[model samples]
Target: MSVEHIQNSVKDVIAYLNENPQDALSNDPPITAVMEDGLRCRATDEDGNTIVTDMPQAIGGGGSAPSPGWLSRAALATCDATRIALHAAQSGVTLDTLEVTTDSVSDDRGLLGLDKSVRAGPLSLRTRVTIGAAGVDQKILREIVDFAVAHSPVADGCRRETPSKVEVRIA
Candidate 1:
């Protein structure tokens, strides 16, 4: 199935929220987390296991704070990375190394109800393109990147804010 594209500018997203306020903002499915060795961790919906562990010491929480939202960023970045690799190969562009770094600046206050500038989720993802494609020029690399951005499912998912409501039915 083709991925759905969301056309919501950052301002548009904010405006939509302003106009259509949620009854209550709550994370769905109640994603679980555990702290061990001063790091927060949690498993997935299938085969419960620790996806991330031993977070570095920061954010006042401990070794590190591996929140649910961070997972989103990680997942998206990984997806984009893989897609970039695949697209490069498919487009006949040979590459020796490809790397993408995604980052976001959120207000801790917004997350903790103390700061106003911090918004939920990553504010941005900066992708650095380094290609070692033989017989490929910068323009081709740029085209591949643009195509990857246009078609990357994770990129679209993040932009769409595709949060599943995920109701736990009582059977």
Candidate 2:
């Protein structure tokens, strides 16, 4: 079947389903980690710490040193890279490999208790895309990368910082 044909059919089917909903959609659970009146915000899990911030790099923290906000940005970058690759594949781009890196800088003094000149984070995510395909050229390759960036959900979510509200419900 043609790509356009499949796309059109998929949308139509989705529209019909929405008109006759079968099940309700819900968000996945979100757990917040907190440190009690501490300078560094910390949370522990069964295995240990927040799994990124600072647990103990040797045992899975930060190796005795962890950069602030690195874990959250790492998660975003990883998700972005995978989503980009998936979109590229769907768009007929045979991606040989993908490497994404994110560097975030904030007011360290203020946010991390350095001096009060630090802020949260304005993460700069840089992705180096390399593609190897028999028939794809430079122009097409550029388009592929653009498409990947455009379609990545994680990239969009991070770039937009889509506002969301968390409601705690107690029953």
Candidate 3:
């Protein structure tokens, strides 16, 4: 889609939100996953889009698909890249190239229950966004990058510490 089209769509959403504020507060459709075999699972969205996930053979799975941690990093990078594109489009900046790279460090000992001091998830994650846009002011591009980072949902989610509770049932 064109930049103008994306900008117009965003404007339309803003207008709708202004007119119907309550409609802006809606939940995302649920995503469900079921185990298939040997640590492999299929996750499906409400719209029926599916993704298969599995651990590496080193971790006792078939090495058929990317592990959840790798997926998380990929999700962060893609989400940031998309946000940057949308915000740049809204600002009338034409990007020739956009790339996002992410690095993360996690302690497997914690996941394996061998170390109580280390966390099970990533201890640190960093992302770098590179853009190539000629004729646009560098300051403006920097501001856009900052705005995208601030507005990205995945970035916000990774930065914040949210509580999670699990309920297990035996059938």
RMSD (Cα, Å) of candidate 1?
Answer: 11.3
Candidate 2 stretches with Cα past 4 Å from truth are 1-26, 34-52, 55-68, 110-118, 123-125, 165-171
- Name the regions of candidate 3 deviating beyond 4 angstroms: none
Residue clash pairs of candidate 3: none
lDDT of 2 at 135: 71
What's the candidate order when arranged by decreasing TM-score? 3, 1, 2
List lDDT for all candidates, in order.
0.64, 0.59, 0.90
- Candidate 1 backbone clash number: 4
- Tell me each candidate's TM-score: 0.62, 0.58, 0.95
Positional deviation of residue 101's Cα in model 1 after best superposition, in angstroms: 1.4
Runs of candidate 1 with Cα error greater than 4 angstroms are 1-39, 45-49, 53-60, 64-71, 115-118, 166-171
Per residue, candidate 2 scores C-alpha lDDT tens digits across 57-111 of: 5433444435445666676668767666555555656656567776655453554
lDDT, candidate 2, equals: 0.59
Query: How accurate locally is residue 8 in candidate 1, as Cα lDDT from 0 to 100?
Result: 27
Global local distance difference test of model 1: 0.64
lDDT of 1 at 77: 76
* Best candidate according to lDDT: 3
Better of 1 and 3 by lDDT: 3
